[model samples]
Target: MADLELLDKSIRRVPDFPKPGILFYDITSVFVNPEAFKYCIDKMVEIYKDSEIEAIAGVDSRGFLFAAPLAEKLGIPMVLIRKKGKLPGDTYSCKYALEYGTAEVEVHKADVEKGKKYLVVDDLIATGGTLVAARNLIEQGGGKVTDFFGVIGLPELNYEKVLAPSKITTLINYSGK
Candidate 1:
C-alpha cells in the first residue's frame, strides 16, 4: 500500500466548491512544499519511468504544473490538454458534464506523433471526466495512453465507468469520504 500520510497532510480540503455537497481537494499546498512536490513528481516518474513513455500529456489547469516537471525529469515533451476553443490550429475536442454544467476540452492535433506512448497527468480524479476527455483527445491524435496519473483520486466516483481500462497510478487517495 502507498501510504499518503505526508501527501494528505500537504493537501487542503475545501468544502462545497463550485457546487453544493462537494468537497474539493485543493493541491496548492502540495505545490508549495518542495519536498512534497518532488516526492510526488519523483514517485510518478519512478512508476512510469520504465513504461517507455514518449510524452507527458497533462490535463488542463492544474495538471499542467506536475506535467511540466515530470516531462523535464523524464526528458520528454509535454502536451497540454485545454478547455474547448483554447487551442489554436487543427485541434481535437471532447465535451462532458461538470458538477454543474457541461464543458469541453481540446488539444493540438499535432502534439503527439502517431503510435507514441503517453502518460496523462492530472491533479485530481473525482468523476474521471477530465481524464477521460484528455485520453480521448490523445487517442484522436493517434497517441496511445499507457497510463493515467493523478495526485489524488476519489473512489466514490465511478472511475471505471468513465475512463478506459488502463493503469491508474496516484500518489494520494481520498475516497470522497
Candidate 2:
C-alpha cells in the first residue's frame, strides 16, 4: 500500500473556509515541503507508469500543479480543464452542481484528440462533481478518461459511488471529518 501519513500531515485543514460550517483541506501546505510534493508525484508515477497513458488532463488550478510535473516525468502531453471562460479557443463546457451551488468547467476542444487516453488529476476529490464535469468534457472531445487521480479523497460524501465505473486513486483518505 502507498503510505501518505507525512503528506497527510503536511495538508492544512481550515474550518468554515469560504463559508460557514464547511471544512477545507488546503494542499498548499504540501507544496511548501519539497519531500512531500515529490513523494506525491513519485507515487502517482509509480501507479501509472505501466498504464500507457498518452496524456494527462489536469482539472483547473490545483490539478495543474500535480499534472504538469507528472506529464513531464512520463513524457506525455498535458491538457488543461479550466473554469468557464478561462480557455481562449473553441471549448466544450460542462455544468455541474457543487455542494453550495452550480458551477461550470471547460476545456479547449482541440486539446483532446480522438482515441487518446487521458488521466484526470486533481489535488483532492470531494463530492466528485468537478471530476465528473472534467470527464464529460474529455469524452465530448472524443478522448477517453483512463482514471481519476487525487492526493486526497473525502469518502464521507461517497464520491466513489458518484464516479462509479471510473477508477479513482488517492494517496490518503480522511473519513467523517
lDDT (CA) per prediction: 0.84, 0.91
Summed backbone clashes in each candidate are 0, 0
lDDT of 2 at 82: 97
Lowest-scoring 10 consecutive residues by lDDT in candidate 1? 1-10
Please identify model 2 stretches exceeding 4 Å from their true place: 1-3
TM-score of each: 0.92, 0.95
Q: How many backbone clashes does candidate 2 have?
A: 0
How many angstroms is residue 15 displaced in model 2 relative to the true structure, after the best TM-score fit? 1.5
The sequence of per-residue lDDT tens digits that candidate 2 reaches over residues 1-177 is 234777878999999997887788999999998888989999999998889688999998999999999999999999999999898999999999987799999999989899998899999999899999999999999998879999999988889887878789999888765
Which regions in candidate 1 have their CA more than 4 angstroms from the true location? 1-3
| Residue-by-residue lDDT tens digits, candidate 1, 3-108 | 3677788898888885777787899899787778878888887887777889989888899999998899889999999988778778998898877788999888
Model 1 residue 122 CA deviation in Å: 0.4
Backbone clash total, candidate 1: 0
Extract clashing residue pairs from model 2.
Answer: none
**Best TM-score among the predictions, by candidate number:** 2
